[model samples]
Target: MKLNMVLDNKKTILVLALVLLSFIGIGSLLPEELTLQRWVAAFFAANALVAMALTFVLSTRLEILETIFRGLDRVYKAHRWAGMWSVFSIFMHWWLVPQSETPRDESSLMEIGSDTGEWATWLLLALVVISFMRILPYHLWRWSHRLMGLVFFVSVFHYLFAVRPFQLFSPAGIAMNVTAIVGLAAWWYYAFGKSTSKHHLAKVQNVKKENGVVSFEAKPLQGRPTWNAGQFAFISVLHHEKIAKEPHPFTIASSQHQGVARFSVAGLGDYTKTLYDHLSNGDMVRLDMPYGRFKLNRSSSPQIWMGSGIGITPFVAWLQELNYTGALTSKSCPNVVLYYLVKNAEAAIFAEELQQLTENLPSVTLKIVYSEEGRITPERIADDLNGNVDNAELYFCGNPEVRKAMQEGLESLGMPKNNTHYELFDFRGAI
Candidate 1:
């Protein structure tokens, strides 16, 4: 991996470090000496709290944080890891706390808090199990996910009355309560906050259909953010009441200078299949601000731009933003080897546009490969690089499994690991 990519990850690590330090510091402030059992309980409890707190904080859907992590995909990766950690820590707590609990004076409030904490812990564990096991429908999973806030509401009392060190309203106790309260608030805002006025209201100007894809253009109801190529916006059509409430992310295919935003949708899923007949000119929709970090490879000298199926949308957007020399980034242009992989002739939805782009740009060479022709192996990319593989950065977007394969192959072929950059379009793992 390039040093920069490793450094990019450090920012997230730094934030997590501070959170862990604060938790430890607070736990240390307790006046009483901790037994071995008590120390183990404190360690696990602090981690469980921090992991859950991070899960909520990362889900605010803030664009700035997405850029900090380089992309929303990485943020989700962190969220997933934090969730897994929370499950592990909470399970340890369930097993360790009873043995460590020192007998205390009897109080009705304390008893309630203790019972709530114990049961809420079980609820949190069950939720994680359901999520990992995929026992429920996607829609139900989302709704069930919101129930975490309710559990948090109950667990807050436990932090105040039952949790050691935290029960004393000490620094750690205060921190735990604050984190829980903020988590509950964030969850409520995410699950119930329905105000969409801030999002640019967009009205469809036209819908063009070709092959299995539908290209749609729309002008915003208000001024929209000035975005770059390779960015995407969350789209929600108000008319599709069944699914309109949930926004879908799509890469913007038009140039930033274009008066309208464009997206190409393939009929691959339930929500998308309805677009063929339901979406029409003059339809109402909402567009969240553009968010992504897959720019024109400013820092690295990108020599290869690879896209498969719908992943080509971002590359098209980049080509539209370039000059006569095919110059787009801050540095002098490098020879760009373009690869567009599709299943068949019908699957080359943007073939005409890509061909025209290659013809007009002297610095770019386009290669179209039907799926049956062959999978794009590492050897093919290395051969196409023509001895430039060492420092040649790759901008790739495609199925996750294919991406993983390509990345592993590239590293083995002497390409820098960090040079493989991409933004995730996969929604299968989404809430």
Candidate 2:
């Protein structure tokens, strides 16, 4: 992959901030003895504070952040990593920072801040543990996760009044203060000011369960939210108590012009299986939308698209979009091949629709690969391209292991790493 692709905007920003903080922390926290160890400990403390602040900001799901990170998925992924780093930094800060043997006089505010810092440490640890516990129900996990903002709020208080090496007016102190305050504001906005602002009230319709895939349409009770074809939305079953109310992301399987949102969900986990069993027509739902950056590249280069199992959802939307816009019949339509991988023909959801769509669009080809036969190897794809792998842009959405293998295989076949694109589908660790 390209260096720019590997170091995304979110990561670049955080890394630069940490580097600056390291300089500031080491320079300002100079000690008479054990200078190196003390400076390192202070830098970790600074890192923990900045990382915790970033965690709160990323959790807000602001549209500008989604744009900066290129997708909400990327933002949430960054949030998870930042949070884990913060917890790690907190432990390092505690372990390395020297403890004084004699007691010193301190104000009540500093004492409170000191005590609260200890509480915040354990609370943050507990929340991070809960985030990793995938076995927990979504609702329980979500509620427990909300306490992170509370912990961050307390940590900021500790940063303010706790005994630090610099004054509040110092550059390091000012920057940390500003960042933490912004993060606190973001947390406030997410928790109180704009909790349900993006949600569209919708009524479920055309519900159908076929071959382990639950397909449905949600017609907006109010104005419909606009989105591109390959993006996804988070949906919550409002009236069903048996189903977890936490919103779950699913690819939009309809064209942008379609007034109603459509989804095809596979029973990949317990919540999804229960949702499939319980969801019905006329069921009220809250749809939070337009999340991913998985849209088709409009370049003139021939494109190779791979989607495994339920990953085919976005391609369905793309076909619907092309057909709806009459782009499939246009002379400018680029040559395209879609490889849909599934266990077998029975598990290939929307296979007939994909075939019919491709038939109409002479420029587009649909190839279904069954597990019984074999996987779609890079060699097969190269032959299909007639030894023209370099000119084709590859897009994939599926099992992470499969993606890794295909990415390496394609690179070995002379495909430019930058020509490939994909979205990390997992969003389970967002806090």
Candidate 3:
């Protein structure tokens, strides 16, 4: 009756079984000259069309509509692997087709190089290059990556027009194409078309520097939406043409009760370098809604939050939520251990606030590790765990290398896989 109930593991198995049965039925309908292997190949090829489109969409983070559009950077490596397989399946279909008995209209390999499939091939090629060329300059990669959306559109068109199987061979093919078109159209509308061309930022209320990081407090011109702990919002400042409409995901650093939002930004790169230098009070800017799954609310277990450098943003938001809800001082609140890895004492933002909160909350423990001053080996995590990591939930927000190391460290320490969570900032290496 419920959506999840209908879409459970058992339902998936059943659907897959039905798909196999349909494949058999279709094979039986074909001429005896058509071998079983060719039928299997054709079936897989058709399946791959949908799978490949899904792969590209997932890689570009299009499936997580709000998050990618709002600029949250957490796309994963598996997204690209899925896309690669999609392309492989398409190739396999062409390679394994029975040459002697193949349909004249659908059997040619040259068809893929023609006008109908040209855009799809070019787009796939571009996506593969842009995804793998991490060694290229960041500016070039950024410019090239924007073309992914164009590639997605062309790929969809190719699936709709170039693949004649929907009309010629099977009803399921038509359904698949219809589903793909509808899904992609809905995503496109939500991302770009529905907006009224107005911005939602209120104004910068205050800016403060503490421990080498700059914090900006803002009030929304439109009322702020309800946001969970550890979520992020895309921020844009007014009249700043270079940065206008280009939203960067920043974790909320202020308590919600203050009726304003705050973002603590470490001066980095082209966008963030001017935070304290140029930003001023009373400047109106647009704020996109919060988007992220890395939050305490997602899990009921006690959490071990690991923060490296400015990756501590989401953890800060979590602390703010605890502070806001009076959970920080409550003995009944779940234990939340925060391990903050910083370069040195200078880079530790909100040290005083963190110290005070840690002091006030018995359930909270803040461990600051200075990587520059001391080594942070996997053994250090085990030592800090003090024999309870197996039961505790792990949440990490940091650079990919640190996140990967932490994940390995925790798993080695016997932490459950399901309990481990991470938030990625820049998905450079990821597809």
Per-residue C-alpha lDDT of model 3 across residues 1-431, encoded as one tens digit per residue: 12322344364466458746754654454345445775666565555555555544544334344343222343344445556765666567655644445445554543442344445555667666666867555556655655654655655555555534335335655555564675465445444553433335578877887665678887776766556777777677768644444566787765565567778888776567766567777777777656666666423346677888877877777776666566544424457778888988888875666777667566788988888888576576666667767766777877778777777887787876655676555556654
Off by over 4 Å in 1: 1-6, 19-23, 30-32, 99-107, 193-198, 241-244, 298-302, 324-332, 427-431
lDDT per residue (tens digit) for residues 1-431 in model 2: 24445666556587558757764664564443446777777677778887877877888887888777777877888788888889998888778877666675565788777677777888888888778976667778777777788888888888888777767876767877787888788777766676666789999999999988899999999886888989989888897868878788888888777777899888888878987898999999988887887886655678888988888888888887777767544535557889999999888877898998777678888899998988789899998888888867888888878888888898899988667778875777544
Better of 1 and 3 by lDDT: 1
**Candidate 3 off by > 4 Å:** 1-41, 55-79, 93-114, 134-170, 183-187, 194-199, 209-212, 274-277, 297-303, 327-331, 377-386, 427-431
The residue pairs found clashing in candidate 2 are none
Residue 253, candidate 3: C-alpha displacement in angstroms: 2.1
Error of 1 at 404 (Å): 2.3
lDDT of 3 at 177: 59
What range of 10 consecutive residues in model 1 has the weakest lDDT sum? 323-332
Better of 1 and 2 by lDDT: 2
RMSD of each: 3.3, 3.4, 6.0
Between candidates 2 and 3, name the one with more favorable TM-score.
2
